[model samples]
Target: MVLIDRIRYLLEKLLEVFTIFLLLALTSIVLAAVAFRTFGSSIAWYDEVASIGLAWLTFYGANLAALKRAHMGFPGIVSSAPPALRMALFVLSEAIVIGFFAVIAYYGYHVFEILAWDRLVSLPSISLTVTQSAIPISAALFIVCECLTLPEAWKKMRAGVDSEHEAIEEAIRLAEEDLKENRS
Candidate 1:
């Protein structure tokens, strides 16, 4: 359990760092592209590189979200169910998601073979393999996150905690505090 927790925390921090880096890269690319275009000189690699950056951001950002347990869910409905059914549904959902991503990772590696000889349209020096690696990599990272958080998910589900409701309540409480501070 200690090892798992340590690994989970490490992955969480790593994903956060990776997602921020991707966001920064994407922002820099867009700003540079806009400036270049304003000067009547468009960059040839701008479009392709920006799209690649967006793809990487989406992939890595998803892993961060997964690790943080920030994905959309109606916890109220799940918590309202009977204990047995709640556990069953929770287990089933997790299984389906993990299995789906495993399949994606498997086929993603095969995609590598097909893309082996392909180069970027705007930059022939850059290989498609390098840019497209986010698929398998993100899928694997997601599985690791899901597994790490499974125990927490199970405990919350078993305890009949409506996580979404709690989150909304916390947000409201924080907003109220901020409003009070502003008034003071």
Candidate 2:
């Protein structure tokens, strides 16, 4: 269990770093494209490349959000439920999330396989599979993030912890801190 936790921690850190890099790269690409177009010079493949970068950014961002337990959910009923009911609901909700991503990963892989031979229209050198691969990759990453957090979530559920409320409070605290830092 310790080893698993360590591995999860490492993977989460790596994913976070990668997501940041992707964000920077996506921003640069879009900004560059806009600058070039404004100067009356346009890169033919800029739009296609930017779109692919956006897809990668979104997918990876979702994976990071899942790892951070930042995804939105209706927690009112769950938070107010009895301990046993809360635990049951938590388990059911997790199952749904995990199952949904698993199905997407499965189908996304198939889609990738089918489009593997195709190439991007504007960027003919790049295969469609390369961009489409983000779908399954992100789904798998999300599953891993959920699985890594499952033990802690289970413990909280057993202890009747209002995770949703806690998460909201945490977000508010972080936001306040950010505002303070900016004002300083």
The number of the candidate with the highest lDDT is 1
Writing each residue's lDDT as its tens digit, candidate 1 over 94-184 gives 9998999999899998899999999999899999999989999999988989999999888999999888987899999999999999999
Report the C-alpha lDDT of model 2 over 25-142, residue by residue, as the tens digit: 9889888889999999988988898888888989999988888777887666777788878878998999999999999999999997689789989989999998899999999999
Give all candidates' CA lDDT scores: 0.91, 0.87
Which regions of candidate 1 deviate over 4 angstroms?
A: none
**Model 2 regions lying over 4 Å from their true place:** 168-184
Ten-residue region with minimum lDDT total, candidate 2: 153-162
**lDDT of candidate model 1 versus the reference:** 0.91
